[model samples]
Target: MVGVMRSCLRSLLKLMNSIIGMVGTGMILYSLWMIRLWHQHLDGGGSISQIPWFIYTFLGLGISLCLITCSGHIAAETANGHCLSCYMVFVFLVVLLEAAVTADVFLNRNWEEDFPEDPTGRFEEFKKFVRSNFEMCKWIGSLIVAAQALSILLAMILRALGPDRGGYYDSDDDYTPARLPLLKPPVQQPPYAVDSHFKLKNDVWNTNR
Candidate 1:
Protein backbone atom coordinates (compact mmCIF):
# COMPACT_ATOMS: atom_id res chain seq x y z
CA MET A 1 0.00 0.00 0.00
CA VAL A 2 2.81 2.39 0.88
CA GLY A 3 4.56 1.54 -2.38
CA VAL A 4 1.36 2.23 -4.30
CA MET A 5 1.04 5.61 -2.62
CA ARG A 6 4.66 6.47 -3.42
CA SER A 7 4.13 5.45 -7.02
CA CYS A 8 1.07 7.66 -7.26
CA LEU A 9 3.00 10.57 -5.81
CA ARG A 10 5.80 10.08 -8.32
CA SER A 11 3.35 10.09 -11.24
CA LEU A 12 1.69 13.23 -9.92
CA LEU A 13 5.07 14.92 -9.64
CA LYS A 14 5.96 14.02 -13.23
CA LEU A 15 2.74 15.53 -14.55
CA MET A 16 3.38 18.68 -12.53
CA ASN A 17 6.94 18.87 -13.85
CA SER A 18 5.69 18.65 -17.46
CA ILE A 19 3.37 21.56 -16.79
CA ILE A 20 6.18 23.61 -15.31
CA GLY A 21 8.37 22.86 -18.32
CA MET A 22 5.75 24.17 -20.75
CA VAL A 23 5.32 27.35 -18.74
CA GLY A 24 9.06 27.89 -18.55
CA THR A 25 9.44 27.48 -22.28
CA GLY A 26 6.61 29.90 -22.93
CA MET A 27 8.14 32.48 -20.62
CA ILE A 28 11.46 32.23 -22.41
CA LEU A 29 9.75 32.72 -25.75
CA TYR A 30 7.87 35.73 -24.41
CA SER A 31 11.10 37.20 -23.11
CA LEU A 32 12.62 36.89 -26.56
CA TRP A 33 9.64 38.62 -28.12
CA MET A 34 9.89 41.43 -25.58
CA ILE A 35 13.56 41.87 -26.40
CA ARG A 36 12.75 42.14 -30.09
CA LEU A 37 10.10 44.76 -29.37
CA TRP A 38 12.52 46.73 -27.22
CA HIS A 39 15.05 46.79 -30.04
CA GLN A 40 12.40 47.98 -32.50
CA HIS A 41 11.29 50.68 -30.08
CA LEU A 42 14.87 51.86 -29.72
CA ASP A 43 15.26 52.06 -33.48
CA GLY A 44 12.13 54.17 -33.70
CA GLY A 45 13.43 56.74 -31.17
CA GLY A 46 11.43 55.21 -28.34
CA SER A 47 14.01 55.00 -25.60
CA ILE A 48 11.28 56.19 -23.25
CA SER A 49 9.34 53.04 -24.10
CA GLN A 50 12.27 50.96 -22.95
CA ILE A 51 10.98 51.37 -19.39
CA PRO A 52 8.04 49.07 -20.07
CA TRP A 53 10.29 46.77 -22.04
CA PHE A 54 12.57 46.45 -19.04
CA ILE A 55 9.53 45.78 -16.89
CA TYR A 56 8.38 43.01 -19.21
CA THR A 57 11.86 41.54 -19.26
CA PHE A 58 11.94 41.45 -15.49
CA LEU A 59 8.48 39.92 -15.35
CA GLY A 60 9.41 37.21 -17.83
CA LEU A 61 12.56 36.45 -15.90
CA GLY A 62 10.60 36.23 -12.67
CA ILE A 63 8.10 33.85 -14.23
CA SER A 64 10.84 31.70 -15.67
CA LEU A 65 12.48 31.49 -12.28
CA CYS A 66 9.16 30.57 -10.71
CA LEU A 67 8.65 27.71 -13.18
CA ILE A 68 12.14 26.47 -12.40
CA THR A 69 11.41 26.62 -8.69
CA CYS A 70 8.18 24.69 -9.17
CA SER A 71 10.02 21.99 -11.08
CA GLY A 72 12.42 21.73 -8.17
CA HIS A 73 9.54 21.46 -5.72
CA ILE A 74 8.00 18.60 -7.70
CA ALA A 75 11.30 16.75 -7.85
CA ALA A 76 11.94 17.20 -4.17
CA GLU A 77 8.47 16.05 -3.23
CA THR A 78 8.68 12.91 -5.32
CA ALA A 79 12.24 11.81 -4.49
CA ASN A 80 13.61 13.12 -1.20
CA GLY A 81 10.86 15.14 0.52
CA HIS A 82 8.73 18.23 0.04
CA CYS A 83 10.68 21.33 1.12
CA LEU A 84 9.11 24.40 -0.47
CA SER A 85 10.71 26.93 1.88
CA CYS A 86 13.62 27.70 -0.41
CA TYR A 87 11.38 28.00 -3.45
CA MET A 88 8.99 30.27 -1.58
CA VAL A 89 11.76 32.53 -0.32
CA PHE A 90 13.23 32.84 -3.79
CA VAL A 91 9.86 33.70 -5.32
CA PHE A 92 9.12 36.25 -2.60
CA LEU A 93 12.43 38.01 -3.12
CA VAL A 94 11.96 38.12 -6.89
CA VAL A 95 8.46 39.54 -6.50
CA LEU A 96 9.72 42.20 -4.10
CA LEU A 97 12.45 43.23 -6.51
CA GLU A 98 10.02 43.34 -9.45
CA ALA A 99 7.61 45.47 -7.42
CA ALA A 100 10.41 47.84 -6.44
CA VAL A 101 11.52 48.24 -10.05
CA THR A 102 7.95 48.88 -11.23
CA ALA A 103 7.44 51.47 -8.51
CA ASP A 104 10.75 53.16 -9.27
CA VAL A 105 9.93 53.36 -12.99
CA PHE A 106 6.61 55.05 -12.23
CA LEU A 107 7.93 57.38 -9.57
CA ASN A 108 10.82 58.62 -11.70
CA ARG A 109 9.22 59.23 -15.08
CA ASN A 110 11.68 61.98 -15.96
CA TRP A 111 14.64 59.77 -15.18
CA GLU A 112 15.42 59.59 -18.91
CA GLU A 113 15.57 63.41 -19.04
CA ASP A 114 18.45 63.23 -16.62
CA PHE A 115 20.47 62.20 -19.65
CA PRO A 116 21.43 65.17 -21.85
CA GLU A 117 19.66 65.66 -25.19
CA ASP A 118 22.73 67.04 -26.98
CA PRO A 119 25.12 64.43 -28.31
CA THR A 120 28.17 66.28 -26.93
CA GLY A 121 26.64 66.64 -23.47
CA ARG A 122 25.19 63.08 -23.54
CA PHE A 123 28.29 61.24 -22.37
CA GLU A 124 29.09 63.84 -19.69
CA GLU A 125 25.54 63.90 -18.30
CA PHE A 126 25.31 60.12 -18.42
CA LYS A 127 28.49 59.87 -16.40
CA LYS A 128 27.40 62.60 -14.00
CA PHE A 129 24.02 60.98 -13.44
CA VAL A 130 25.60 57.61 -12.85
CA ARG A 131 27.91 59.14 -10.28
CA SER A 132 25.14 61.10 -8.52
CA ASN A 133 22.53 58.32 -8.46
CA PHE A 134 25.10 55.60 -7.91
CA GLU A 135 23.92 55.02 -4.37
CA MET A 136 20.24 54.77 -5.23
CA CYS A 137 20.67 52.67 -8.36
CA LYS A 138 23.15 50.50 -6.55
CA TRP A 139 20.62 49.78 -3.83
CA ILE A 140 17.97 48.83 -6.33
CA GLY A 141 20.36 46.77 -8.42
CA SER A 142 21.59 45.08 -5.26
CA LEU A 143 18.09 43.99 -4.37
CA ILE A 144 17.60 42.43 -7.82
CA VAL A 145 21.01 40.82 -7.64
CA ALA A 146 20.24 39.44 -4.21
CA ALA A 147 16.99 37.94 -5.42
CA GLN A 148 18.71 36.27 -8.39
CA ALA A 149 21.41 34.92 -6.10
CA LEU A 150 18.88 33.46 -3.71
CA SER A 151 16.95 31.88 -6.59
CA ILE A 152 20.12 30.27 -7.91
CA LEU A 153 20.97 28.94 -4.46
CA LEU A 154 17.53 27.46 -4.05
CA ALA A 155 17.75 25.82 -7.50
CA MET A 156 21.09 24.29 -6.51
CA ILE A 157 19.70 22.90 -3.28
CA LEU A 158 16.72 21.45 -5.08
CA ARG A 159 18.95 19.88 -7.70
CA ALA A 160 21.00 18.27 -4.97
CA LEU A 161 17.84 16.78 -3.50
CA GLY A 162 16.58 15.66 -6.93
CA PRO A 163 16.86 12.12 -8.30
CA ASP A 164 19.15 13.11 -11.15
CA ARG A 165 22.17 15.38 -11.34
CA GLY A 166 20.52 17.10 -14.32
CA GLY A 167 17.58 17.99 -12.09
CA TYR A 168 15.01 16.96 -14.70
CA TYR A 169 12.40 14.18 -14.84
CA ASP A 170 13.57 10.84 -16.20
CA SER A 171 11.87 10.58 -19.54
CA ASP A 172 13.66 7.38 -20.50
CA ASP A 173 12.09 5.40 -17.67
CA ASP A 174 8.58 3.91 -17.91
CA TYR A 175 6.29 5.93 -15.62
CA THR A 176 3.10 3.98 -16.44
CA PRO A 177 3.92 1.31 -13.90
CA ALA A 178 4.06 3.93 -11.17
CA ARG A 179 0.60 5.14 -12.08
CA LEU A 180 -1.16 1.72 -12.37
CA PRO A 181 -2.75 0.05 -9.36
CA LEU A 182 -2.16 -3.52 -8.22
CA LEU A 183 -4.81 -5.98 -9.35
CA LYS A 184 -6.39 -8.86 -7.43
CA PRO A 185 -8.12 -11.99 -8.81
CA PRO A 186 -11.90 -12.29 -8.39
CA VAL A 187 -13.33 -14.99 -5.98
CA GLN A 188 -15.04 -18.09 -7.51
CA GLN A 189 -18.46 -19.38 -6.48
CA PRO A 190 -19.66 -23.07 -6.34
CA PRO A 191 -22.23 -24.36 -8.87
CA TYR A 192 -25.83 -25.03 -7.65
CA ALA A 193 -26.85 -28.70 -7.03
CA VAL A 194 -30.31 -30.35 -6.48
CA ASP A 195 -31.40 -33.47 -4.52
CA SER A 196 -32.96 -36.13 -6.78
CA HIS A 197 -35.00 -37.67 -3.84
CA PHE A 198 -37.09 -34.51 -3.28
CA LYS A 199 -40.52 -34.68 -5.07
CA LEU A 200 -43.64 -32.50 -5.21
CA LYS A 201 -46.82 -33.78 -3.47
CA ASN A 202 -49.59 -33.37 -6.09
CA ASP A 203 -51.80 -35.64 -8.23
CA VAL A 204 -49.87 -34.74 -11.48
CA TRP A 205 -46.54 -35.02 -9.66
CA ASN A 206 -47.41 -38.52 -8.31
CA THR A 207 -48.18 -39.73 -11.87
CA ASN A 208 -44.92 -38.30 -13.18
CA ARG A 209 -42.91 -39.80 -10.27
Candidate 2:
Protein backbone atom coordinates (compact mmCIF):
# COMPACT_ATOMS: atom_id res chain seq x y z
CA MET A 1 0.00 0.00 0.00
CA VAL A 2 2.84 2.40 0.80
CA GLY A 3 4.59 1.54 -2.44
CA VAL A 4 1.43 2.20 -4.40
CA MET A 5 1.01 5.56 -2.77
CA ARG A 6 4.60 6.49 -3.57
CA SER A 7 4.10 5.52 -7.19
CA CYS A 8 1.01 7.68 -7.46
CA LEU A 9 2.70 10.66 -5.88
CA ARG A 10 5.69 10.24 -8.19
CA SER A 11 3.44 10.17 -11.22
CA LEU A 12 1.64 13.32 -10.10
CA LEU A 13 4.94 15.12 -9.46
CA LYS A 14 6.17 14.16 -12.92
CA LEU A 15 3.01 15.53 -14.50
CA MET A 16 3.46 18.80 -12.62
CA ASN A 17 7.06 18.98 -13.76
CA SER A 18 5.92 18.48 -17.35
CA ILE A 19 3.53 21.39 -16.98
CA ILE A 20 6.30 23.55 -15.55
CA GLY A 21 8.58 22.69 -18.47
CA MET A 22 5.84 23.58 -20.93
CA VAL A 23 5.29 26.93 -19.21
CA GLY A 24 9.04 27.62 -19.40
CA THR A 25 9.12 26.75 -23.07
CA GLY A 26 6.13 28.97 -23.73
CA MET A 27 7.82 31.88 -21.97
CA ILE A 28 10.96 31.44 -24.02
CA LEU A 29 8.99 31.35 -27.27
CA TYR A 30 6.99 34.39 -26.29
CA SER A 31 10.12 36.32 -25.43
CA LEU A 32 11.66 35.43 -28.78
CA TRP A 33 8.50 36.45 -30.62
CA MET A 34 8.49 39.73 -28.80
CA ILE A 35 12.09 40.31 -29.77
CA ARG A 36 11.30 39.59 -33.40
CA LEU A 37 8.46 42.10 -33.34
CA TRP A 38 10.65 44.65 -31.63
CA HIS A 39 13.28 44.23 -34.31
CA GLN A 40 10.73 44.72 -37.08
CA HIS A 41 9.28 47.78 -35.40
CA LEU A 42 12.66 49.35 -34.84
CA ASP A 43 13.81 48.79 -38.45
CA GLY A 44 17.41 49.64 -37.58
CA GLY A 45 16.32 52.88 -35.98
CA GLY A 46 17.66 51.73 -32.60
CA SER A 47 20.83 49.87 -31.75
CA ILE A 48 20.97 46.30 -30.38
CA SER A 49 21.57 47.77 -26.92
CA GLN A 50 18.13 49.35 -27.05
CA ILE A 51 16.35 45.96 -26.79
CA PRO A 52 13.78 45.98 -23.98
CA TRP A 53 14.98 44.61 -20.63
CA PHE A 54 11.79 42.59 -20.06
CA ILE A 55 12.73 40.25 -22.90
CA TYR A 56 15.97 39.34 -21.20
CA THR A 57 14.17 39.03 -17.87
CA PHE A 58 11.61 36.61 -19.29
CA LEU A 59 14.30 34.67 -21.09
CA GLY A 60 16.30 34.25 -17.88
CA LEU A 61 13.21 33.25 -15.93
CA GLY A 62 12.30 30.67 -18.59
CA ILE A 63 15.77 29.17 -18.55
CA SER A 64 15.74 28.94 -14.77
CA LEU A 65 12.34 27.29 -14.85
CA CYS A 66 13.55 24.74 -17.37
CA LEU A 67 16.49 23.86 -15.15
CA ILE A 68 14.23 23.48 -12.12
CA THR A 69 11.79 21.35 -14.14
CA CYS A 70 14.57 19.00 -15.19
CA SER A 71 15.74 18.71 -11.60
CA GLY A 72 12.21 17.92 -10.42
CA HIS A 73 11.73 15.21 -13.06
CA ILE A 74 15.04 13.61 -12.22
CA ALA A 75 14.21 13.66 -8.53
CA ALA A 76 10.84 12.06 -9.18
CA GLU A 77 12.29 9.32 -11.38
CA THR A 78 15.21 8.41 -9.13
CA ALA A 79 13.36 8.71 -5.86
CA ASN A 80 16.65 9.45 -4.16
CA GLY A 81 16.60 11.22 -0.83
CA HIS A 82 19.12 13.88 -1.77
CA CYS A 83 17.57 14.58 -5.13
CA LEU A 84 14.10 14.89 -3.68
CA SER A 85 15.37 17.15 -0.92
CA CYS A 86 17.13 19.51 -3.30
CA TYR A 87 14.16 19.50 -5.63
CA MET A 88 11.85 20.42 -2.78
CA VAL A 89 14.13 23.25 -1.74
CA PHE A 90 14.18 24.64 -5.26
CA VAL A 91 10.42 24.38 -5.53
CA PHE A 92 9.94 26.03 -2.16
CA LEU A 93 12.12 28.93 -3.20
CA VAL A 94 10.06 29.40 -6.32
CA VAL A 95 6.82 29.29 -4.33
CA LEU A 96 8.19 31.76 -1.82
CA LEU A 97 9.18 34.14 -4.60
CA GLU A 98 5.75 33.99 -6.20
CA ALA A 99 4.06 34.48 -2.87
CA ALA A 100 6.22 37.47 -2.06
CA VAL A 101 5.41 39.08 -5.39
CA THR A 102 1.73 38.42 -4.94
CA ALA A 103 1.72 39.83 -1.42
CA ASP A 104 3.56 42.90 -2.59
CA VAL A 105 1.08 43.47 -5.38
CA PHE A 106 -1.91 43.18 -3.03
CA LEU A 107 -0.51 44.92 0.04
CA ASN A 108 1.60 47.66 -1.46
CA ARG A 109 -0.42 50.45 -3.00
CA ASN A 110 2.64 51.90 -4.78
CA TRP A 111 4.13 48.61 -5.93
CA GLU A 112 4.57 50.04 -9.41
CA GLU A 113 7.14 52.42 -8.03
CA ASP A 114 9.40 49.46 -7.22
CA PHE A 115 9.78 48.67 -10.94
CA PRO A 116 11.48 50.75 -13.60
CA GLU A 117 9.48 52.17 -16.50
CA ASP A 118 9.07 50.02 -19.62
CA PRO A 119 9.29 52.10 -22.78
CA THR A 120 7.40 49.44 -24.79
CA GLY A 121 4.39 49.66 -22.41
CA ARG A 122 4.21 45.81 -22.39
CA PHE A 123 3.92 45.84 -18.63
CA GLU A 124 0.74 47.93 -18.77
CA GLU A 125 -0.64 45.70 -21.49
CA PHE A 126 0.06 42.62 -19.35
CA LYS A 127 -1.78 44.21 -16.40
CA LYS A 128 -4.70 45.00 -18.71
CA PHE A 129 -4.76 41.45 -19.95
CA VAL A 130 -4.87 40.11 -16.39
CA ARG A 131 -7.66 42.50 -15.50
CA SER A 132 -9.70 41.47 -18.53
CA ASN A 133 -9.26 37.77 -17.81
CA PHE A 134 -9.21 38.07 -14.05
CA GLU A 135 -11.25 34.97 -13.39
CA MET A 136 -9.26 32.77 -15.74
CA CYS A 137 -5.93 34.14 -14.57
CA LYS A 138 -6.89 33.80 -10.94
CA TRP A 139 -7.88 30.18 -11.33
CA ILE A 140 -4.79 29.41 -13.36
CA GLY A 141 -2.50 31.05 -10.82
CA SER A 142 -4.23 29.25 -7.96
CA LEU A 143 -3.89 25.92 -9.74
CA ILE A 144 -0.22 26.52 -10.42
CA VAL A 145 0.47 27.44 -6.79
CA ALA A 146 -1.48 24.42 -5.60
CA ALA A 147 0.44 22.15 -7.90
CA GLN A 148 3.77 23.49 -6.66
CA ALA A 149 2.71 23.14 -3.06
CA LEU A 150 1.56 19.59 -3.65
CA SER A 151 4.75 18.74 -5.47
CA ILE A 152 6.81 19.93 -2.54
CA LEU A 153 4.73 17.89 -0.12
CA LEU A 154 5.04 14.75 -2.23
CA ALA A 155 8.77 15.22 -2.58
CA MET A 156 9.17 15.52 1.18
CA ILE A 157 7.15 12.38 1.81
CA LEU A 158 9.06 10.39 -0.79
CA ARG A 159 12.31 11.61 0.68
CA ALA A 160 11.28 10.28 4.06
CA LEU A 161 10.44 6.91 2.47
CA GLY A 162 13.36 6.70 0.10
CA PRO A 163 14.86 3.70 -1.64
CA ASP A 164 17.73 1.79 -0.12
CA ARG A 165 21.30 1.62 -1.45
CA GLY A 166 20.16 -0.91 -4.06
CA GLY A 167 17.54 1.52 -5.37
CA TYR A 168 14.65 -0.56 -4.05
CA TYR A 169 12.02 0.08 -1.41
CA ASP A 170 12.57 -1.89 1.75
CA SER A 171 9.55 -4.17 2.08
CA ASP A 172 10.15 -5.19 5.67
CA ASP A 173 7.08 -4.81 7.87
CA ASP A 174 7.79 -2.30 10.60
CA TYR A 175 5.09 -3.55 12.91
CA THR A 176 6.12 -7.21 12.92
CA PRO A 177 8.26 -8.43 15.82
CA ALA A 178 11.51 -10.26 15.19
CA ARG A 179 11.58 -14.06 15.61
CA LEU A 180 13.51 -15.36 18.66
CA PRO A 181 15.99 -18.28 18.48
CA LEU A 182 14.61 -21.67 19.56
CA LEU A 183 15.82 -23.34 22.80
CA LYS A 184 17.09 -26.95 22.76
CA PRO A 185 16.40 -29.72 25.41
CA PRO A 186 19.31 -31.36 27.26
CA VAL A 187 20.25 -35.05 26.54
CA GLN A 188 19.32 -37.61 29.26
CA GLN A 189 21.05 -40.87 30.50
CA PRO A 190 19.87 -43.74 32.67
CA PRO A 191 20.10 -42.93 36.41
CA TYR A 192 21.11 -46.56 37.45
CA ALA A 193 24.00 -47.02 35.01
CA VAL A 194 26.70 -45.32 37.14
CA ASP A 195 25.53 -47.06 40.37
CA SER A 196 25.48 -50.46 38.62
CA HIS A 197 29.06 -49.94 37.35
CA PHE A 198 30.25 -48.89 40.82
CA LYS A 199 28.56 -51.91 42.44
CA LEU A 200 30.30 -54.28 39.97
CA LYS A 201 33.70 -52.75 40.84
CA ASN A 202 32.97 -53.06 44.58
CA ASP A 203 32.04 -56.72 44.18
CA VAL A 204 35.23 -57.44 42.27
CA TRP A 205 37.37 -55.62 44.87
CA ASN A 206 35.76 -57.58 47.75
CA THR A 207 36.34 -60.90 45.98
CA ASN A 208 40.02 -59.95 45.31
CA ARG A 209 40.48 -58.87 48.92
Candidate 3:
Protein backbone atom coordinates (compact mmCIF):
# COMPACT_ATOMS: atom_id res chain seq x y z
CA MET A 1 0.00 0.00 0.00
CA VAL A 2 2.84 2.38 0.85
CA GLY A 3 4.59 1.45 -2.37
CA VAL A 4 1.45 2.19 -4.32
CA MET A 5 1.23 5.65 -2.78
CA ARG A 6 4.87 6.38 -3.55
CA SER A 7 4.42 5.32 -7.14
CA CYS A 8 1.41 7.60 -7.43
CA LEU A 9 3.35 10.53 -6.04
CA ARG A 10 6.20 9.90 -8.49
CA SER A 11 3.78 9.71 -11.38
CA LEU A 12 2.16 12.95 -10.26
CA LEU A 13 5.55 14.66 -10.08
CA LYS A 14 6.39 13.49 -13.58
CA LEU A 15 3.07 14.79 -14.85
CA MET A 16 3.75 18.18 -13.29
CA ASN A 17 7.22 18.27 -14.82
CA SER A 18 5.74 17.41 -18.22
CA ILE A 19 3.28 20.28 -17.91
CA ILE A 20 6.14 22.64 -17.05
CA GLY A 21 8.13 21.32 -20.01
CA MET A 22 5.22 22.00 -22.37
CA VAL A 23 4.88 25.55 -21.08
CA GLY A 24 8.61 26.12 -21.57
CA THR A 25 8.53 24.65 -25.07
CA GLY A 26 5.56 26.83 -25.98
CA MET A 27 7.35 29.95 -24.74
CA ILE A 28 10.50 29.08 -26.70
CA LEU A 29 8.58 28.39 -29.91
CA TYR A 30 6.54 31.60 -29.58
CA SER A 31 9.67 33.67 -28.96
CA LEU A 32 11.34 32.10 -31.99
CA TRP A 33 8.28 32.73 -34.15
CA MET A 34 8.21 36.36 -33.04
CA ILE A 35 11.89 36.71 -33.89
CA ARG A 36 11.28 35.18 -37.33
CA LEU A 37 8.40 37.54 -38.01
CA TRP A 38 10.50 40.51 -36.94
CA HIS A 39 13.31 39.42 -39.26
CA GLN A 40 10.88 39.15 -42.17
CA HIS A 41 9.49 42.57 -41.42
CA LEU A 42 13.00 44.03 -41.46
CA ASP A 43 13.67 42.51 -44.91
CA GLY A 44 17.47 42.88 -44.76
CA GLY A 45 17.04 46.56 -43.87
CA GLY A 46 17.53 46.21 -40.10
CA SER A 47 19.98 44.52 -37.75
CA ILE A 48 19.17 42.10 -34.88
CA SER A 49 19.63 45.01 -32.49
CA GLN A 50 16.20 46.27 -33.59
CA ILE A 51 14.57 43.23 -31.96
CA PRO A 52 13.04 43.69 -28.53
CA TRP A 53 15.18 42.55 -25.56
CA PHE A 54 12.14 41.09 -23.78
CA ILE A 55 11.87 38.46 -26.49
CA TYR A 56 15.41 37.33 -25.69
CA THR A 57 14.50 37.40 -22.00
CA PHE A 58 11.58 35.09 -22.73
CA LEU A 59 13.82 32.79 -24.73
CA GLY A 60 16.31 32.61 -21.87
CA LEU A 61 13.54 31.98 -19.37
CA GLY A 62 12.09 29.23 -21.53
CA ILE A 63 15.45 27.48 -21.89
CA SER A 64 16.07 27.71 -18.16
CA LEU A 65 12.63 26.31 -17.38
CA CYS A 66 13.11 23.43 -19.80
CA LEU A 67 16.44 22.56 -18.24
CA ILE A 68 14.97 22.72 -14.77
CA THR A 69 12.06 20.48 -15.75
CA CYS A 70 14.47 18.00 -17.28
CA SER A 71 16.26 17.87 -13.95
CA GLY A 72 12.91 17.41 -12.27
CA HIS A 73 12.19 14.42 -14.46
CA ILE A 74 15.52 12.83 -13.58
CA ALA A 75 14.94 13.51 -9.91
CA ALA A 76 11.55 11.84 -10.02
CA GLU A 77 12.87 8.82 -11.86
CA THR A 78 15.99 8.20 -9.80
CA ALA A 79 14.75 9.48 -6.44
CA ASN A 80 18.31 10.57 -5.71
CA GLY A 81 18.77 13.03 -2.87
CA HIS A 82 21.16 15.30 -4.72
CA CYS A 83 19.09 15.53 -7.91
CA LEU A 84 15.90 16.18 -5.94
CA SER A 85 17.68 18.82 -3.83
CA CYS A 86 18.96 20.64 -6.93
CA TYR A 87 15.58 20.45 -8.63
CA MET A 88 13.88 21.84 -5.54
CA VAL A 89 16.39 24.70 -5.36
CA PHE A 90 15.83 25.72 -8.99
CA VAL A 91 12.06 25.39 -8.66
CA PHE A 92 12.04 27.31 -5.39
CA LEU A 93 13.97 30.16 -7.03
CA VAL A 94 11.47 30.29 -9.89
CA VAL A 95 8.55 30.27 -7.43
CA LEU A 96 10.23 33.00 -5.40
CA LEU A 97 10.64 35.16 -8.52
CA GLU A 98 7.00 34.67 -9.48
CA ALA A 99 5.89 35.54 -5.96
CA ALA A 100 7.97 38.72 -5.99
CA VAL A 101 6.50 39.78 -9.33
CA THR A 102 2.97 39.07 -8.07
CA ALA A 103 3.58 40.99 -4.86
CA ASP A 104 4.90 43.98 -6.80
CA VAL A 105 1.93 43.89 -9.13
CA PHE A 106 -0.47 43.92 -6.18
CA LEU A 107 1.33 46.27 -3.78
CA ASN A 108 2.81 48.87 -6.08
CA ARG A 109 0.77 51.35 -8.06
CA ASN A 110 3.76 52.35 -10.25
CA TRP A 111 4.73 48.79 -11.19
CA GLU A 112 4.32 49.51 -14.89
CA GLU A 113 6.97 52.22 -14.64
CA ASP A 114 9.53 49.63 -13.49
CA PHE A 115 9.20 47.61 -16.75
CA PRO A 116 10.56 48.80 -20.08
CA GLU A 117 8.08 49.67 -22.81
CA ASP A 118 7.48 46.66 -25.05
CA PRO A 119 8.38 47.31 -28.66
CA THR A 120 6.24 44.34 -29.75
CA GLY A 121 3.21 45.54 -27.73
CA ARG A 122 2.71 41.97 -26.51
CA PHE A 123 3.17 43.04 -22.91
CA GLU A 124 0.35 45.58 -23.27
CA GLU A 125 -1.82 42.95 -24.90
CA PHE A 126 -1.09 40.54 -22.05
CA LYS A 127 -2.02 43.17 -19.48
CA LYS A 128 -5.26 43.84 -21.36
CA PHE A 129 -6.03 40.15 -21.50
CA VAL A 130 -5.41 39.77 -17.79
CA ARG A 131 -7.61 42.76 -17.07
CA SER A 132 -10.40 41.39 -19.23
CA ASN A 133 -10.32 37.97 -17.56
CA PHE A 134 -8.99 38.86 -14.18
CA GLU A 135 -10.76 36.06 -12.31
CA MET A 136 -9.63 33.38 -14.72
CA CYS A 137 -6.08 34.72 -14.70
CA LYS A 138 -6.13 34.88 -10.93
CA TRP A 139 -7.22 31.25 -10.63
CA ILE A 140 -4.64 30.19 -13.20
CA GLY A 141 -1.89 32.09 -11.45
CA SER A 142 -2.91 30.59 -8.12
CA LEU A 143 -2.93 27.09 -9.59
CA ILE A 144 0.52 27.53 -11.09
CA VAL A 145 1.87 28.71 -7.73
CA ALA A 146 0.14 25.80 -6.00
CA ALA A 147 1.55 23.29 -8.48
CA GLN A 148 5.08 24.55 -7.85
CA ALA A 149 4.53 24.24 -4.13
CA LEU A 150 3.13 20.74 -4.50
CA SER A 151 6.04 19.67 -6.68
CA ILE A 152 8.47 20.83 -4.01
CA LEU A 153 6.52 18.92 -1.39
CA LEU A 154 6.39 15.76 -3.46
CA ALA A 155 10.11 15.94 -4.18
CA MET A 156 10.84 16.28 -0.48
CA ILE A 157 8.74 13.21 0.28
CA LEU A 158 10.46 11.19 -2.45
CA ARG A 159 13.91 12.21 -1.25
CA ALA A 160 12.98 11.18 2.25
CA LEU A 161 11.78 7.78 0.96
CA GLY A 162 15.19 7.15 -0.67
CA PRO A 163 15.59 4.82 -3.61
CA ASP A 164 13.01 2.18 -4.47
CA ARG A 165 13.21 -1.34 -3.02
CA GLY A 166 13.31 -2.88 -6.47
CA GLY A 167 16.49 -0.99 -7.22
CA TYR A 168 18.55 -2.76 -4.54
CA TYR A 169 17.18 -6.32 -4.30
CA ASP A 170 14.57 -8.61 -5.69
CA SER A 171 11.34 -8.91 -3.71
CA ASP A 172 10.91 -12.67 -4.18
CA ASP A 173 14.46 -13.77 -3.51
CA ASP A 174 15.67 -14.60 0.02
CA TYR A 175 19.16 -13.12 -0.14
CA THR A 176 20.20 -14.03 3.38
CA PRO A 177 22.10 -17.10 2.25
CA ALA A 178 23.79 -15.24 -0.59
CA ARG A 179 24.91 -12.50 1.79
CA LEU A 180 26.42 -14.95 4.31
CA PRO A 181 30.23 -15.27 4.34
CA LEU A 182 31.82 -18.54 3.23
CA LEU A 183 32.83 -20.84 6.06
CA LYS A 184 36.49 -21.75 6.45
CA PRO A 185 37.59 -25.42 6.99
CA PRO A 186 38.57 -26.43 10.52
CA VAL A 187 42.39 -26.51 11.19
CA GLN A 188 44.08 -29.94 11.62
CA GLN A 189 46.59 -30.31 14.53
CA PRO A 190 49.87 -32.27 14.10
CA PRO A 191 50.08 -35.69 15.85
CA TYR A 192 53.08 -34.59 17.92
CA ALA A 193 51.19 -31.64 19.26
CA VAL A 194 48.21 -33.87 20.25
CA ASP A 195 50.57 -36.21 22.13
CA SER A 196 52.77 -33.56 23.76
CA HIS A 197 52.43 -35.06 27.24
CA PHE A 198 53.61 -38.52 26.02
CA LYS A 199 56.60 -36.95 24.26
CA LEU A 200 57.51 -34.98 27.40
CA LYS A 201 57.35 -38.27 29.56
CA ASN A 202 59.58 -40.08 27.03
CA ASP A 203 62.07 -37.20 27.12
CA VAL A 204 62.10 -37.36 30.96
CA TRP A 205 62.65 -41.14 30.89
CA ASN A 206 65.47 -40.82 28.36
CA THR A 207 67.10 -38.13 30.55
CA ASN A 208 66.76 -40.35 33.61
CA ARG A 209 68.31 -43.42 31.77
Models 1 onward score TM values of 0.35, 0.74, 0.78
lDDT ranking of the models: 3, 2, 1
Q: How many residue-pair clashes does candidate 1 contain?
A: 0
Cα displacement (angstroms), candidate 2, residue 62, comes to: 1.6
Between candidates 1 and 2, name the one with more favorable TM-score.
2
lDDT of 3 by residue, 103-154 (tens): 9999999999988866766677768989999999888778767778888999
Tens digits of per-residue lDDT, candidate 2, 43-81, equal: 967545444777778888788788989999999988988
Candidate 2, clashing residue pairs?
A: none
In the range 1-209, model 1's lDDT, one tens digit per residue, is 54454455455444444444454566666566656765676687764622453436545774766565565555445454344454445456656766785576569976666433432233344458767998987785565455445544544444444443233655635665665554644465658655455533455587987
The candidate 3 region of ten consecutive residues with least summed lDDT is 177-186
lDDT of 1 at 206: 79
lDDT of each: 0.53, 0.81, 0.84
